[model samples]
Target: MKSILFSTTLIAFLALIPAGEAAAQLIPQPWVSVGSRNDETTFSIGARALNLGVEFGLGTEDSTGVDALAFVNLPLIDQVSPYVGLGLYSEDQGVAVSGGVQINPTDNLILGAGYHSIRGVNGQVGFRF
Candidate 1:
């Protein structure tokens, strides 16, 4: 069945992660974000492993969602760093295309604004190590 094939593929991919050349560059950090979408406020708590991050959201109207994002981190002349990402989302409201920009004013804090194709606009503030 398709499900079996998908599960097998996923397991194989996970098994190979530890052998990746960039494994040493993976930094895991706890992350939190608050945003607005579909005229409702949404909050997410998750972890970032290198350029990839996954989060679960608690939104208004009791809607909940999950997101998997991959981002590019760009460092500027000042201490600021900006990142852009594209990803997939699964939400109680509906599925969506998710992408966002996060800016780090300092090494620990982040200010972000973003959008989801189906969920609408978003903003966030979080701290990470």
Candidate 2:
């Protein structure tokens, strides 16, 4: 009797959750960026959940050696929105500021070009879930 009751409760609880919400966890929303920082090549890879994003960056030889940015902007589906971020520049041992606008051409594709206080101009491509 206890086994049957437990099984029934588990089934009911699972059914109460939305399918889309559950499936979103299985889908990947990733982003990549490349550009110049301090006149050297920079690259970053990242992922997003809702409006929040976190990316790790390699700032090349001229700038800081490595950095990371954590930001919140309009969600990935939005056509255009300004993004403001705070980051760390490891070699300089200082805080980094990132700001730009991200452009979304489709539900799954994002394109961005912008300037930064330390990282300079960059173009980003991202995927939405």
Candidate 3:
């Protein structure tokens, strides 16, 4: 199941990229996202500097966690960029392996899905400035 989702995401990303162009910088922007994980609603606030970012999340479990992530973005024809990231979270959440992908349909809108080793899967939506 995970393989299928990964493969499909890869295919979609490849299909969107142009023949020749540099991948855009995806992590340097200040962004915020809201989503749900394992039936628990989550909210994240973060700022990305260069290829790395730091984020804080509030979960319905009544715990607040912090994560540091590294991102790689592939530009898929203009502003349609797809990015993948891996991160580590700390605090009451301890250390949970986390990773995700986000696709930018427009310059300001982002849609994504992610998985957390302890928190389960999530669906995300956000805006980038």
C-alpha lDDT of all candidate models, in order: 0.63, 0.66, 0.62
Best candidate per TM-score, number?
Answer: 2
Model 3, residue pairs in steric clash:
none
1-129: candidate 1 lDDT, tens digit per residue: 999999999778567555552463265656667667667766777666656777677755676677777766453443333444443444455664677677667767767777765445777777755
- Candidate 1 segments exceeding 4 Å error: 1-25, 75-92
Q: Which residue pairs show collisions in model 1?
A: none
Model 3, residue 32: C-alpha shift (Å):
3.0
Output candidate 2 Cα RMSD: 7.8
Clashes of 3: 0
Q: Count the backbone clashes (under 3 Å) in each candidate.
A: 0, 0, 0
Question: Mind giving the per-residue lDDT tens digits that candidate 3 earns over 26-125?
Answer: 3355666666667777777766644566767765466667677776755444443334444444445656566777666877776767765544566666
Model 2 is weakest, by summed lDDT over 10 consecutive residues, at 65-74
Error of 3 at 6 (Å): 34
Q: How far is candidate 3 from the true structure (C-alpha RMSD, Å)?
A: 9.6
> How well does candidate 1 match the true structure in TM-score terms?
0.60
Highest-lDDT candidate: 2
